[model samples]
Target: MIKTIIFDFGDVFLNLDKPATARELKKHEISNFSEAMLQKNREYEKGLMTSEEFVEEYCSSFPQLNSEVFTGSWNAILLDFPKHRLEFLKRLKREGKYTLILLSNTNDIHIDWVKENVEFFDEFKNCFDGFHLSQEINLRKPDAEIYEYVLAQHGVTPEETLFIDDTSENTKAAAELGIQVWNIDPAKEDVTDLFTIKKDLF
Candidate 1:
């Protein structure tokens, strides 16, 4: 039986145009997302590098682009958070049937946009018993250690938790630790359908 629920925030909740950032950056003739740049992104996500350092690296790479434009393009992937999903999460919190948690791989730049755009960002967050942000925790998904950290922190057994994420890699990592998972496709499904879609697990 699942006593706890761990959720991923990006596609699972807030809609994201995953390719928007790359597309926008390419327009500025910054076509190469080199291996080093990818590594830097991973470091930024893991909170190993501060936002100032992260932005500086990109600025140095593309001296032609202004910081404001670079920041805007970097945050282009974020989209709207459907109000219905917020209601569904609120209902779940009220029921108190499970310990709800949010585990997201996010960075400061993206989070800043979310806070400003999502009207209920604060309320939506209050619904979770535990909230873990990659930048804040210095950990990220698709890594076994992060999952282990959440499990240990909550004192929840893998078998007793259900982890929902839109990324297959992330779900795969969680499953390795014996946790139940729902690797959702945001294009075809919505988080609000959790009860009906994953009824077997519930």
Candidate 2:
């Protein structure tokens, strides 16, 4: 039985344009991210660097790019948080069947944008029994340590936990630890159909 439910924030609960940031940056003549930039981004997501320092690094690398423009392009990936999803989560919370936990790999700037844009962000957050953000925890997903951390922190057995994520890489990593996972495809599937889609689990 699935006693605990772990959900990924992006693409699962919130809508995201995965290619938006790259597409936006390309318009600024930043064709692709260099190895250094990718490393810096990983560091930034892990809370090794502050938002100011992250923007400064990019601005310094591309002298023509200012902090404001870079930050704008960086946040282009985030889109809307649909009302129905929040309603679904709220309904689940009210049932009090499983321990609902949110596990997301996100940075400070993106979350700040979410807080400003998503009106019901606080209410949505309150639905989770445990909310773990990558930047705040200094750990990002697809890394085994992060999955181990969540399981240990929640005191939940891997066999009894169901982790839902939009990325195959993340879901695969969690599955390796004996946790059941739904590698959801946002384009065709909606999270509100969780019970119907995985009826056997329930």
| Index of the highest-lDDT prediction | 2
Least well predicted 10-residue stretch by lDDT in candidate 1: 25-34
Residue 85 in candidate 2, Cα distance off native in Å: 0.5
The digit string of per-residue lDDT tens for model 1 on 1-202 reads 8999999999988999999998999898877778989999999999999888999999998898878989999999999898998999999999999999999999998999999999999999999999999989999999999999999999999999999999999999999999999999999999888889999986
Question: Model 2: what TM-score?
Answer: 0.99
User: Model 2, clash count?
Assistant: 0
Q: Which regions of candidate 1 fall more than 4 Å away from where they truly are?
A: none
- Cα displacement (Å) at residue 130, model 2: 0.5
Error of 2 at 128 (Å): 0.5
Cα deviation in Å at residue 56, candidate 2? 0.6
- For candidate 2, write residues 56-91 as lDDT tens digits: 999999887999899999999999998999999999
lDDT values for all models = 0.93, 0.95
Q: How do all models score by TM-score?
A: 0.98, 0.99
